[model samples]
Target chain A: MLLSPSRLRGLGSRVPPCSSFRPFTAAAAAAASPTSKPQVYLSRSRNPYLNLSVEHHLLQTTPPDSTVLFLYTNRPCVVIGRNQNPWLEVNLPLLSSLTARTKPGDHEPAPTTIDLVRRRSGGGTVFHDPGNVNYSVICPPESFDRDKHAEMVVRALRGLGVPGARVNARHDIVVDVDVDVDVSESDGNHGANTFKISGSAYKLTRLRSLHHGTCLLSSPNLGSIGPLLRSPAEPFIKARGVESVRSPVRNVGVGNGEFEDAVVAEFAKMYGDPDVFCEVGDEAGAVDGVEKGMKELLSRDWIYGQTPLFSFSTYPTEDDPRERPSLPSDFHLSFEARHGQLSKFTFVNASSAGHVDIPSSSSSSPLDGSRIYDVEDWTDALRSYGGTVNSQAETAGRWLNGLFGTGHAKTQLR
Target chain B: MASIARCVRAARPSVLSTISKPIAATSRPVFYRPTQRCFSATPISEVRKYTKDHEWIDLHADNKTAVIGISEYAAEALGDVVYVELPEEGATVAQGDSIGAVESVKSASDINAPVSLRIVQSNVELEEKPAKINRVPEDDAAGGGWLARVEVDEQGLKEFEGLLDLEAYKEFTATLHE
Candidate 1:
């Protein structure tokens, strides 16, 4: 349905998109219309998968030209880009350890299950918690701009007295914090005072464009984020997809309710008051396609199989030459993986009498065709290669196990 | 050359300029050649055809295969493409299926199949240097930003016929801006 500027004049009062609308609808089963109105939905579901599914449903079912605003906050989770390599981007071992922590701590035991999600968007990885409010804007393809809504968020932050908040060159919202120049410079890397408060990513289908961002507001896990996002294999792996640009982040010092309300007001300023404003919960799963989308998001295939092709090398190679960290054994190991399956592999034990390279074709090693996610022990995976299982090999395996998040059960989804 | 599709330039530049233009833009035709040509084959249109979604397909001389890529306007609108997730070769996709996806300006946009076809080859160069897409998004040559080469079937030919020609696509985009 094509809408001229003139036709959008009076339709503001009653935008016509949702097939059925109640004050607090259980599901989001809206249909597209010629004369569509702007819609706003605030999610009560803390499940990242469910919230993402509802967002996807809205992106698919909304009118091609209508604008939408969806606000949701998920429990502790590390969300990666659609095409990113999770092993390279996230510290899976750290995630597993935190998820396994059952002991009661000063603060509740570190989130029992921190979900590892691969979102259907493109960008670097981000850490999301209940303290972080996620806002999504979906509009027509022609009207899509990466920074347009991010700027609106900056306005919202400023409205909430974050006067230093502004959209940075990378489209992330950052705040300029004043620091003692003498003391900060003593730390050797204190030139920039800006701390990112929000990070943005986008997904564009044929008909609609969706931009979503994470606004950090009083997250207790801020200190833990650095370790959780840093991977042990970062130095040894060369990946093909997007890599996260590290930035110092801080909270906007506002409540989630205040941020959400300010953002909604800013959104209303841009597209007029929303025709459909309501809060949706897990009941959104009852929508026509939300269940299927949630299932896909939760599947191992989508989480691991969607990774771009990448290569891992223990020693320095010409393609990715750098000073190598000393390994326990003088082992030369390298492999190429596409879609998380080992396609080619080479393992050599230089410590043995005259280093012998184990060609993957001749060796019946279990690592071949093995999904990286399923490997529970790198030592066992390497022990079956018919070589002397020396302490050096065991040590190398233990290091690899830590790097690859092996030797522990995969974290269960919450 | 007539089979090569082209699109109008998008008026607005994308928000992010992080994607630097590729230093070299080379036309290296890297596609599988079909030897057999049927004389009684239906005469497929020689001109390029476009989907409303901003994808374009150019039928090969054999009329059984075509090359697909996003339009120039789409490339400009997408800003600098950082990566392209190429579809697996030898995979058959129905019409409207996502053939691949392109990432630019932190946005992942699907490049849908213009018609039902079996992909035979993909542009691997774009995987290494994605900026080539911003430089030559419509170039079907080997090093060009063309996404894939697919063998079309009878139904694909019918679907192709329904796509908009270059002129109609121009008018359609104009209306969108209006």
Candidate 2:
């Protein structure tokens, strides 16, 4: 039933669209309004095999206030934020593994291709497939409040009877279950408090706007998704090991179809307000926009040009010296200075027989008088008596004298 | 792959077992969609020349230099550009060669050189913070946000004649309306 704004205004009382209100439009008043609705548009289709041409057409041409609900059913696919680099966000090997699973005779039309699609928003990477429903709320900038709109959608789902269904701060609709319960209550709390779900992003043009996301109604192929969407390398920390990074809560599809239908119906009702909904297929303008965007998305420079250069530093360890020793007396010393402060010192000795003594009071020996020997004279004497001096004595003396150094003493006894 | 699908299919029964009942007993009515419009107006000026890519160049009366940026329609189409990569000063670029890139949250597009020219200055603020591009796409030295300035070549001046005039581009874009 059409609920024109002018007609709704005439109804006098400001009844919310969710209420069982009468159609205020004159045309609607004359026609019999059906109470039960069929064929609820969930959002735009999230089909991987969705024609890019059609997708572009719809986006460029669709008028504002058009709500398109799509059910994405197919193999797993990676959808990147409009401005993100696929190489930076995705694990190449994992993607390759998922791609390998595709055989020549997979299906007649072939399941939606899973490589990468640059969406028109600034969110993070999300895995999509048939089990998930992708929803797009295209509206005017004034009508779309990111937080409020997401909350409204969540409220609609809760209204549909999904127990404990609440919109997280990140704009994701979440429910609690007790299977393995791998998802930490801590994480759920963080999501509720932090307002982040898998990651919701948006794009608003002058005339057309869209905020789209995946509602994982069913448990996706975790084996494929987990392996494919693994996080990129991170700093080595025990708590955030690769295994921890890979763990994620499976989608709700692992539950029942009746429940899924109820959730889907609720979302459809929330998105399908006759006052807010405009039904239109792919049009020319959106197609042109998509074509332009696709051209840019597929461009070599656009795809790979802005990558940040990465560099790492490597320093030689004492165990792996820069140069191998050729003679028994050969030795090397390395020192590090930072901000004019002596930070570290390392020494390597390749002596075969003679005791290498670093005597205290080398000043008295007429050797380099300024040289501070770490070893005391008595300790050096004792070490010298041993066929070859391998000094724990020198190390201990260095500690006592506060001449901080790290070194390896190599010697062969005669 | 099929086995994985079967696993998901098998788990479906268990997934529904855990979902709580709907919060509200009564179903809510549906929501209404909104009407959207596209920005298609083209600027009007004899001195202003437009690129097929939608960038416009306004040649200064001095004839030696010109200010260049995406057309108003192009900017609107790109949404809020968060970052802009500008060409380096002293670098010579050919007409139509990509000089830099502009990134919005949902999209990224290359900024092609409208004329064969030598870059004299680049907007440094964009390097440190990219959101300035979205805030002001045409602010020159006065605003501290103009993308770049370039010394135009003789051939570039000749090529300018072939570009779309204001009225022609406006009409061209208007045809795209639904």
Q: Pick the candidate with the highest TM-score.
A: 1
DockQ of all models, two decimals each: 0.36, 0.07
Error of 1 at B15 (Å): 15
Question: Runs in model 1 with CA error above 4 Å?
Answer: A1-33, A99-111, A181-191, A351-365, A389-393, A407-413, B1-46, B167-178
Instruction: Please give the clash total of every predicted structure, in order.
Output: 3, 45
Across B7-114, the per-residue lDDT of candidate 1 in tens digits comes to 112445331221123212234333443575543354343467888787889886667978888777677666778889887899999988877888876878888888
Q: In candidate 1, how many clashes are counted?
A: 3
lDDT of 2 by residue, A1-414 (tens): 433334433332343231211211211332243332222222232334233333433434444335433222334566665445443455543453344223222343334335555554555667765555555544444444455445644654454454455666445555655445444422233333221223345654434445665666553343456545543321110110001122243454322333334434444455444322222222211334444655555543333332322111112243333432232234323322211122223233434212553222232322121112122242342244232234443542332222211110100000
Per-prediction TM-score, chain B alone: 0.77, 0.65
For candidate 1 chain B, the 10 contiguous residues with the lowest summed lDDT are B1-10
**Per-residue alpha-carbon lDDT of model 1 for A9-31, expressed as tens digits?**
33422443333234224223334
